[model samples]
Target: MLLYIHIPFCDSKCHYCSFNSYVDLFHLRESYMKALSVQLAYELKRFKATPGSIETVFIGGGTPSTVRPELYRPLFETLRPFIKTGAEISSEANPNSATSSWLEGMFALGVNRISFGVQSFNNEKLKKLGRAHNADDAAAAVLRAEQAGFKHLSLDLIYGVENDTKVLLAHDIEEAFKLPIDHLSAYALTIEEGTPFASIPDVANEKLALTEWFLKRIKKRFATYEISNFGDYRSKHNLGYWEHKDYIGLGSGAVGFLKDTRLYPTIDVQAYINDPLSIQSELLSEASIKTEKIFLGLRSIVGVDEQILSEKEQNRASLLVKEKKLIYENGRYYNNDYLLSDELALFIEQ
Candidate 1:
């Protein structure tokens, strides 16, 4: 089993972000962590989590670094008995908020990995993205994490924004390689509804050729595990999601999955604090579950199991295999090129 904890607090909201995070809710940090502990207790019973059953833990957010480590200690203490030995514990951080003391504190609490949201190494691009940290601050924060004894470090980079040239992207990749990070996530800019960027959708400006070129540059140093993710050390928590493992999502704005049911707690921080056990559940049909597996499998190294396909879908998959679009081995079909994963899944389903 895997676990995810959400921290919906940020110092500032990015122009292009639509995640359920708030900048004004900083006052509720303490109350929110307390609420999270309440939810954790309920979910432990609901998910039937056994001792040493949790394989990985990921703390994502509005910005996880905004909260002090002491605020997180209660949750870790409760989870310690259920976490497997040498489990991967990761947290998402921002360069501006992830101070030296913060990094040391989290490391001392058994968080061995840090995934920094260092979207770019160019100051101009950073401003365009409304990022809180400049290029230098990002570099310094990452070095601090390494100095604090983090064994695995990862950072994110964004591409396909307006005025993204090969020279600019190449420089970004070069700067990232200089860091001691083993994992990198390169995402193309996409306009999401209800975001500041939504008013000016053209700011995204993705060019297919440029995106492919940028990915190739990063792939030179790290291996691509998914279309947007590359790393020498793949994240077990990330792979767990693609593999459809059962996970308990703690906190507001978080989603949890078990068997065929999806669980959601409230998105409002205040409401969640009042009653953390007030969760909504959705059931997934078998057909929908199978479809999800196919799409997820084709997008990463986790290939689709042959037994999950119908006879008609199997025939279509065989055709793709014959045409060199997929590789069939060990009773599973693997995608050779992640770019065509969606199209391939659609063809098989159709």
Candidate 2:
């Protein structure tokens, strides 16, 4: 099972972010760690996770790098018995806070992979996005991670903003290749319902053709494993989710899946710190799981199994295959183009 730990702290809030992070609650770091450990230990026992059973551990958040590495030592000790040997343990970091010392310290604590939040390479674009780190900080962070002996490094790049030009994104992509990275997550900017960008004028989804061009160029060196992610090394933690594997979440604003139920911990940072064990859950219905399986399968390398769909849906899928929108082979149907995954799913389901 995959394990995800959310660290809800950031040095500064980004304009486009809606994550449950806090910049003003710096004083709560130490207490938060204690609370988190308490919660994680309880979860491990409740879930009955045996030693060397967890396949992956992904620590994500507002900026996991903001907290001192030593703060995580106790939690590591608690999880050590349960973590599988040579398992992929990764954490999300911000370029500004992910110093060389921090990277080395975390690595020593058993985190082998670091996914840096370097959203863009252009200084102006970084400013527009209200990112704390400059372009140079991002490049320097990657080099620092390399020098620190980290084998797996990934970076995130945001494209498809309002009034953005292809030349701008193309430059970002080119600069990305200049760094030593095994994985890349290219996300199209989306204006969420409550983010600052949502009120901005002209916010829209990226053009399909331009996105395809970026994916095509990236495929030259990296494998297009997911719709928004590409890499020589696929993320085991993310793949587990797409393939409907069980996972446990260990903090505020984190989601955990256990069989047919979805667990949602408190979103308020302070509240979660106060009562880490408290959680709200939703028991998933078969229809909900089936719909999710179809949608997730069509969106990534995981394809929908032929037997999962009804006979009518299967026949519709076959028609789509003939229309060249899907590829059916070995009792599974895959989306020919990820951009049309939703449309194809809707058509087949109808």
Candidate 3:
């Protein structure tokens, strides 16, 4: 089993973000931490002795580093009793919010991994994304994290912005490589509906393709271990999700899958705080699990088992193999290259 803790508070909202995050909710930080502890306790009791080891615990969302360091003590105190030894406890931080003191506090609380959200190194591009920090701040944050004794550091970079050139993308990657980071997650910018970036007229199909090429180049430069995620070491927690392993998610807007049921908590903070047990749970059918296994399995570097693909699917895989898009070896299929195109994967699967 794995665990995920969602911290849904950001210093400022990014233009392309649609996650259940809020800005300037500092006043409610204490109450939110208490509510999270209650939810964690409730879930722990509900799944008593399920016979599994938690290999990883990822604290993601809004911007976990934006939360007050003092408020994190109780939260980590509640979790410390349950987390197994050698578990990778990671937390996400935005460049602007992760201060030196904040990193030290998190390290003291047993957070060994720090993933920074440094979307771009370009100052103008960072502004366009409405990010709170500039390129220098991103570099400084990583240095601070390293100084705080964080060995496993990861940085996120977005590629293919409008008018973003290949040279610019290369420079961004080069800057990230200079940081004392063990992992890199580079994502192609997608224009999701209802985001500020979605309404911008500059976002074009050609720009999207350019972004894709940039991502491919990045994968080549920094060993792509998974689609959208590349690093020296793969994220064990995220791998659990791709492999369809069980996990417990705690906090508002969290989702957990356990014992054939999928539970999604209310997105509203107040609603979750008032009724911690008020979760929308559904019993997942076998077919649902099977479909998800195939979909998610293909997304990872570790490809699906040979038995999972039908004869027709095998033939499609063969076509991809011929096209040099996929390769079959050692009774498994892998993308011919490191980069896994979602559209191409869907086409091959269908």
Candidate 4:
């Protein structure tokens, strides 16, 4: 089983961010964390997690570094017995708030990986994206994390925005390689509903050729494990999701999955604090689950198991194999190119 914890507080709201994070909820940080503990206790019992059963843990957010290490101590203590030996524990941090002290503190708590939200190394792009950190701050923060003894360091970069040139993206990749990071996630700028970018949709100008070129540049150094993810060290937490493993999601607006059911806790921070156990569940049909498996498997290194497909779908997959769009190995069908993952999944599904 896998575990995911959400921190719903941020230093500032990024204009392009539509996540369930808040800048005004600073006062409720302590109470919200306490509420997480309450829900976690309940989830542990509900999930029937055994000792050393959990393989990975990912702490994502608004920004996990915004919370102090002391605040995370109790949760780690509670998780210690359940976590397997050498489990990968990761946390997301922003360059501005992930101070040296914070990095050391989280490292001491047994977090082996740190994924920073360094959207871009270009100061102009950083400012336009409403990021709270500059290029220098991002560089320094990553260096600090390395000094803090984190072996698996990762950072994010945004691309396909308006005025994105090959030179600009090449520079971004150049600056990223200078850091001591083993993993990188390059995402295209997509305007989400209710985000500031939604009003100025033209700000997101994703050119397929540029995206392919940018990914190729990064792949020259690190291996591509997924369409957006490249790493010398692939994240076990990320792979767990693609493998459709059961996980416990702790926090408001967080989603959990167990077999065919999806669990959703309340999204309202105050309501969650009042009653963290209040959750809604969605049951996935066999067809829906199979569809997800196809999409996720195609998009990543994970290949779809042939046994899961119906006879008709298997025939469709066979056609792709004949066309050389997919490679049939052993008893699975693997995607050769992740760029066409969605289209391939749809064709098989249809």
Candidate 5:
């Protein structure tokens, strides 16, 4: 089983972020951590699963580094009883707050992987994105993590910004390769409704060429295991989700999935703190799970199983294979085009 814990506090809010995170919620950090520990203990016992059985644990959110690492000590001690050998524990941190001490403390507490939110290397671009970290801060923080003995370091990059040029994209990729990084996630800027960038026109479609170009360059070093994620090291936490593995989601704003049920904890920060186990759950039908498998598989390296699709769907997929749009090998159908995968999956399913 996979595990996800959300730390919903941020030092500052990014303009385009829509995640369930809060700014200026520092006063509640200690209390939230305490509440989270209680909920985790309860969930583990209720689920009838040992912590050691959990393969991956991803601690994500507003900015996990913003919280004091020492506050996490108690939770680690609680988890030690069930944490198995060779488990991959990951945490997300913004470059601005991922200090040397913070990185060290987390490492000492069992966090082996670090995913840094370094959207861009350009200071002006970072300012526009409302990121608190400067370019130098990003570089310095990463080196510090490396120095702290983290072997699994991944960097996130946002491409397809308004009027983003080829030179700009190349420079970002070039700068990224200079760091001691193993994984990279390149995503197009999305104007989610209610975000600061929502009023802006979507330029992702217009920037496909640049995206393709950047991929061509970056792929020389990193493998394209997924549509957006690439690297020498693949994130087990991420791959587990796409594979539809059973997982436990702890903390407010976190989601978990079992055989048929999807659990969501309270999104209201104060309410979640008051009652961290107050989770709302949704039931997933067999058809829903089947559809999700197709969608997620075609979008990543996880190709869909042959028997999962109906005869008609298989025929359509076979036709696409004949046309070289899909590749069928090793008893499964795989997507050849990330951009066209969604449309292709729909057509085959239909």
Candidate 6:
């Protein structure tokens, strides 16, 4: 089992972010933490025994690093009884908010991994994205995390930005290589409807092609283990999700998938604080689970099981194998390259 905790507080919202988070809610911190404890306790009671062996714990958020380190003490304490020994505890930190003391405190609290959101090293791009940290801050933050004794560190980068040229992309990759990190997650920028970036002019299809080209180049430089995520040490918690393993999510705006049920909590912070047990749960149909398995399996280096495909699909696979677009060996099929091609997956479906 894997556990996820959502901390919904940020110093400021990024222009392209649509995650459920609030800015300047320091006053509500204590109350929110208390509510989180209550929610976890309630979930524990509801899911009896809970297997007792949690493989990973990922604390993601609006900005977990922005919260006071002392506030996290109770969180670790509450989770102690449930976490298995040697569990990988990870926390997401924004570059600007991650201080030396804060990083040390998190490590002392059983967090073994730290993922920093260092979107880009370009000052102009950082400004356009509304990120609080500059390139120097991002580099310093990683060094600080390492000095604080965090052995496992990961960094995030965004590609496919309207202004991202090949030269800029190369520079970002070069800057990332300078840091001592075990993991890297690079994603194509998508403009969600509610995000501030949505109002900006959309990049043309040709620009998107360039984005893909840049991503391919990066993938060659850094091994691509999964779609959008690349690392020397891949994220076990996220891998669990891609592989269809069960995970429990806690806090406001948290979503969990336990066996067949897809459970979600109230999105409103106040509503969640008022009634901790009000969860919206839905039992997914069998077909939905199977479809999910296919979709997710295709996204990773581990392709779908041969048995899942029909005879026609198998024939198509043979054609792909001949064309050198895919390879089948040791009872598994894989894309010829690590970077996934959506077109290939779509063609296989047809």
lDDT of each: 0.95, 0.89, 0.81, 0.95, 0.88, 0.83
Superposed model 4: Cα runs more than 4 Å off: none
- Model 6 per-residue lDDT at 28: 83
Q: After superposition, how far is residue 1 of candidate 1 from its true place, in Å?
A: 0.7
| C-alpha RMSD values across all candidates | 0.6, 1.3, 2.3, 0.7, 1.4, 2.2
What's the lDDT for residue 121 in model 2? 89
Tens-digit lDDT track of model 3 for 161-274: 676888888889889989898788877677877888889936523365676677776666567767778777778887889878777888889899887899898889878778
Candidate 2 CA-lDDT value: 0.89
Relative to the true structure, candidate 5 reaches a TM of 0.97
Q: Poorest 10 consecutive residues of model 6 by lDDT?
A: 201-210
Total clashing pairs in model 1: 0
Per-residue lDDT over 217-334 for candidate 1, one digit per residue giving the tens place of the 0 to 100 score:
8888899988789999999999999999999999999999999999999998999999999999999999999999999999999999999999999999999999999999999999
Candidate 1 has a TM-score of: 0.99
Which stretches of candidate 1 lie above 4 Å from their native place? none
* Per-model TM against the reference: 0.99, 0.97, 0.91, 0.99, 0.97, 0.92
Better of 1 and 2 by TM-score: 1
lDDT: the better of candidates 1 and 5: 1
Q: Tens digit of lDDT per residue, candidate 5, span 1-350?
A: 88898999999988889998889888999999999998888888766776478888899998999998899998888887676789899999999899899999999999999999999998888988889998899989889999999999999999878767888778888889999999999888887778777776553344667878877788898998878899999999889998889888888889989889999989988898899879898999999999999999998889899899989989998999999999999989999778787998898888
- On the 0 to 100 scale, the lDDT of residue 313 in model 1 is 97
Candidate 5 error regions (>4 Å): 202-206
The Cα error of candidate 1 at residue 88, in Å, is 0.2
Which residue pairs in candidate 3 collide?
A: none
- Pick by TM-score: 3 or 4, better one: 4
* lDDT of predicted model 4: 0.95
